[model samples]
Target: MENYKIPDNLAVSEEGFLFLPATGESFTLNEIGKIVIGLLKNGSSIEEIIERLTEEFDVDEHTAEKDVNDFLTQLKNFRLVEEI
Candidate 1:
């Protein structure tokens, strides 16, 4: 499994608020998003993320995988995270 990283220009707050200094654009995320970002920042692998989500949220592995993939795709689309 590979890890993902949030770029330095992307600032994240305790309340799941994300800000891009270069573009002056900001976005807010839900609790789950915050957890995912935190885990990514901590160098957690993709599989680890799915496992954590399943355990914490009581979701099945298949559903967790789908949601996590969707969330990661959104982050990538917004240029918020990079494959590392």
Candidate 2:
């Protein structure tokens, strides 16, 4: 476990909309990715995050763990998150 930063130029609207820059290319997020980002924005720990997702999404602990780890790895590779 590491912490990550939410991209400053992007945000979620009050209405729960994803806001990306007009000049930036649009990137669609999947269901799990959306939940991960939501928890990350809320300052949840990696372990807490996986726990939350597992409970909220009706996913098994093992599946949630694997998905979150893989998702974080991809986000890091894309520069969407930097270790903190």
Candidate 3:
């Protein structure tokens, strides 16, 4: 699993609203998305995120892994996260 990073110019609210200062773009995240982003901001690896998701949410390991992968893809597509 790779480590991901949230850009320095991006601001994320407690309610999962994301704003990119450079692009003047804003996005709202779902609950799971918010958790994933927070974990990424804390420098958690994908594996760690999966573990946390499984532990914190009512999800199994395989399901959590799949969901996290899908979310990561979305983050990449949105230019919100980078592999580092």
Candidate 4:
């Protein structure tokens, strides 16, 4: 995967929140999203992301799987993330 190419229109707002521009929608992220995005910026792997999230959020594996998939899907749908 091309690690450097984060979606052009995706950015953290002034209040440090993620925003997806294509849909004119805003996402007020919890700490998990913030940390995940930071890791993504540093080219972290999906596996690494899962590990970090699980450690930080105290969520079980199954719940983490579902939430990560759902979040990534939404990002993909809005073109806020690219698979590379």
Candidate 5:
């Protein structure tokens, strides 16, 4: 699976707040979204992300995969991340 990366123009806060300097846009992420973003930025693969989520959140593999894919889709839609 391809890895994802956050743009340098996107700024993230410890409290799950996101900002895009160039666009003057800001977003707030839920706990899971924040966790996913951190993992993505740290160079985690999609499978690795799903595994980590399952380990941390008491979620099953299928659900973890769905959620991770959905979140990544949303981030892509928002231009927050680019696939590599």
Candidate 6:
């Protein structure tokens, strides 16, 4: 699992709206996305996030890992997170 950092200029609303101060771009996140982003911002490792997801969402480990990986890839593609 890799560590990632959310950009310092990014702002996340309580309702899961993500805004980039640098580019003035905004995006919305689903509930799961919100949780993942929150955990990532808190410095949680990918594995730790998987564990938390499984415990919180009634999802299996495999599903959680896959989902997290996919979400991380999307974040990377969007330039919202950087590998640390």
Candidate 5's residue-wise lDDT over 1-84, tens digit each? 678898977899999999999889899999999999998878888899999999998889998998888888889998999878
Model 1 Cα lDDT, one tens digit per residue, 1-84: 556899977899999999999989898999999999989888888899999999998799999999999999999999999998
Model 3 CA lDDT for position 70 = 86
Give all TM-scores, in the order shown. 0.93, 0.74, 0.93, 0.70, 0.94, 0.96
| Number of the predicted model whose TM-score against the real structure is largest | 6
Which structure among the candidates has the greatest lDDT?
A: 6
Question: For model 1, what is the C-alpha lDDT against the true structure?
Answer: 0.90
lDDT of 5 at 28: 100
lDDT per residue for candidate 6 within 1-84, as digits (tens), equals 679989888999989999999889899999999999999899999999999999998899999999999988899989999899
Runs in model 4 deviating more than 4 A are: 1-5, 19-27
Off by over 4 Å in 5: none
In order, candidate lDDTs are 0.90, 0.74, 0.90, 0.70, 0.89, 0.93
**Candidate 3: where is the Cα deviation over 4 Å?**
none
Model 4: clashing residue pairs? none
Regions more than 4 Å wrong, model 6: none
Pairs in clash, predicted candidate 3:
none
lDDT of 2 by residue, 1-84 (tens): 677766777655544455557445445577667777877887787899889887888889999888888988887765666566
TM-score of 2: 0.74
Clash totals for all models, in order?
0, 0, 0, 0, 0, 0
How far residue 65's Cα lies from its native spot in candidate 2, in Å, is: 1.0
Query: In terms of lDDT, which candidate is stronger, 4 or 6?
Result: 6
Clashing residue pairs, candidate 6?
A: none
Query: Model 1 reaches what TM-score against the true structure?
Result: 0.93
Please tell me which model should have the higher TM-score, number 2 or number 4. Answer: 2
